[model samples]
Target: MKVYLWVDKDIPNVYGQVAVRAGSIDEPADFTGLAHYLEHMLFKGTQEIGALDWAKEKPMYEQIIKLYDEKAKLRDPKKDKAKRDELTKKINELSVASSKISKGSEFPTLIQAAGGTGLNAYTNFDQTVYHNSFPAYQMENWLKLYYDHFQRPVFREFQAEMENV
Candidate 1:
């Protein structure tokens, strides 16, 4: 059965989250970070939330991968200066394009329309959490914002999401 809850100061706030009960540890070695990436994408919202222009989001998302890929290379104490600089350039290019997707976009405006703030989401080692804290009256709006994504999502791409962490 469907249920509802809230989290706030006045009335008691209630909400829900899904626990996968597994993670990268359970995936095939070839899958590597696939599980981790999928965790992040889960919150990309779904067809129901709104259309996710993946065509355009893809290029932006790829740069996100470049950003993380460069960071990974930098971690090596013996990493070559030339190679590092090359990756850095790619990352910068991608970061710039990715920022465009987030600039004053309607998504932020709609999420805020729910009558609350701090409606955010995250992915972790063994879990993916999608939640928000709003005043009691915003339950329906909040639910609409969260439902389709929680039910089924279309994330930009895991490679893009890694940039956030």
Candidate 2:
């Protein structure tokens, strides 16, 4: 990863951005909105940040992933309405269960607690960028949080996030 630092003594806040080369253009043709969906999922947080009980949540989350995968495979929803609806119902059920053990929005909550602002990310045709500005004194906290963010992002609210995408 390439790191860029701009130090301005007069500024009270430090702005950090991490951009990845992959974006909508990188998604498989069949999975058009996947990149954007991923952008939303990244904020859901990792095991260390979002989960109150990862042990119990992991299996339920895996089931949700599997259901989504199956749903994705059934191309024509009209033709496979029964199967698709079944999968959708299961995904929703698992998501609700998973949410029970998840600390939803904890990632941004942490940043806000540390005096951060503009905590957001965007996905474009060629790249996806995550960024935020934090009080200069909170630089260390920002770095550690983002490091964990990229290293171990969990798809906690997949179905709900997909709706936003």
Model 1, position 111: C-alpha lDDT score: 65
Mind giving the per-residue lDDT tens digits that candidate 2 earns over 1-165? 877777788999888888999899999997898998888889999988999999999999888877878887897858999998888888888888889999869999999999999998999999999999899988878889989999988978776777788
Candidate that scores best on lDDT: 2
Per-model TM-score versus the true fold: 0.49, 0.88
61 Cα displacement, candidate 2 (Å): 0.7
Model 1, range 40-145, lDDT digits (tens) per residue? 5665545444344546755665566756666765756565766777766776676566445543233345666755566555545665555555556666666666
Give me the runs in candidate 1 sitting further than 4 Å from their true place: 1-9, 12-22, 52-109, 157-159, 162-165
lDDT of 2: 0.88
**Backbone clash count for every predicted candidate, in the order shown:** 4, 0
* Candidate 2 wrongly placed segments (more than 4 Å): 8-10, 76-79
